[model samples]
Target: MGLVTIEKAHVASELLVLKSKLESEGVICYLRNEYTTQIMNYLPSFEVELQVSELDLEKVREIMTRKDAE
Candidate 1:
């Protein structure tokens, strides 16, 4: 299955927590540019991306929307 970027976080810690949340809900997560972003944090454009399966895109979005409401 293809992966789709679901969110971008400036810090790895943020994505770590989100990864845990998504995994608990049975959605596998992949982090892209996590280490690169940390190493190059001085650059404003670098961001850690939270990615999930393309099929899980809508499910992840729904979960995140509920999280935002809380």
Candidate 2:
């Protein structure tokens, strides 16, 4: 399945939390550039990306939107 990024976090800890939240909701999530970001924390442009199957893109976005509202 093709993957699509759903969220980005500058901090590794925040990325971890987001990943955990998505997985808890039964969404298969992945962290892209996680280790790279951690190793190159000085680079502001290098942020961790949370990704999921393209089919789950809309669902993930909706969940994140509702989370932000709360």
RMSD of each: 1.5, 1.6
lDDT of candidate 2 over 1-70, digit per residue (tens): 6999877888767877778878888989988998998899999999888889998888888888878898
Clashing pairs in 1: none
Query: What's each prediction's clash count?
Result: 0, 0
**Model 1 spans > 4 angstroms off:** none
Model-by-model lDDT, in order?
Answer: 0.88, 0.85
Candidate 1 per-residue lDDT, tens place, 1-70, comes to 8999987988878878778988999999999998898789999899988899999988899888878898
lDDT of 2 at 53: 98
- Candidate 2 residue pairs in clash (backbone atoms < 3 Å): none
